[model samples]
Target: MTHRYLKNVVSLELDKDKCTGCGKCTEVCPHNVFIIENGLAEIIDRDRCMECGACANNCPFEAVTVEPGVGCAAAIIKGWLTGSEPSCDCSGGDSSSCC
Candidate 1:
């Protein structure tokens, strides 16, 4: 009954190997998803992330990646109830019809 890859799993995964420690991802992230730990952007306060694609877009090194945005179960449920787009943006728009 669980929607795989359609659930709210907002967590920052830092690829330490790729992280150049540019600090760009940390700076633009409105949720403060990254931090400088040993000169690398460590995953800190991941729950605070809103998954707005800021981290992914801002990540110049392509080190950090996350399924950002709307981890709220209620919202996903509501979207389903109203035939709206699922939680993920794979549809390429804000509504289900766009999918």
Candidate 2:
């Protein structure tokens, strides 16, 4: 079997206009990906983000979204090998992993 190198890249996008200052996204994130400045969620650490999707799922106003998941290389590779579609936290209605 040929092995593929895993690259877990997570995108952190916040819709400032849609945010309602609920602070839910910042609360659910385990990797400390966001910070509140002027009552808005800011992307502080994109590299550290695990892609857990907690923020997107918890956001009440749907202001935040990600291709959510843990961003773990090994985990994603395993999922791919097993023929299961990888999951993301900000997947909207795709599926739930940690969010």
Candidate 3:
């Protein structure tokens, strides 16, 4: 699947030392951001991540760390201008509170 991306703002840190190569991340990622090879889960496409928190939530070994937020400059600017909280609509507005 081809996942669209605006920017790579999601803070994803993969600790290979903690990964068990379970491929669980691959299964839960909607954007195909993770790939398992040589008994390890590698971040093949960090930019494609939508910060949905699925990979981190599903990982049993807690190998994946994701901050789960958006990088929308327009939303941020709008929030500042409107004096409201910035939120990302991707995946769901509730996932990323970018104000």
Q: Taking the tens digit of each residue's C-alpha lDDT, what string does model 2 give over 15-86?
A: 999987777777888767778889877877676666667888888888998876554555577577877665
| lDDT digits (tens) for residues 1-99 of candidate 3 | 764666756688899999999999999998788988998999998888877788999999998998864457867776788787765543355674444
Best by lDDT: 3
TM-score of every model versus the real structure: 0.60, 0.64, 0.66
Candidate 1 per-residue lDDT over residues 1-99, each given as its tens digit: 622343345656778999988999878887666788888878766666667778787887788787755656756876888798556454545455322
What's the candidate order when arranged by decreasing lDDT? 3, 1, 2
Q: Which is the winner by lDDT between candidate 1 and candidate 3?
A: 3
Candidate lDDT scores, in order, read 0.71, 0.71, 0.81
Residue 16, model 1, lDDT: 90
Whose TM-score is higher: candidate 2's or candidate 3's?
3
**Best candidate per TM-score, number?**
3
Model 3 accuracy (lDDT, Cα):
0.81
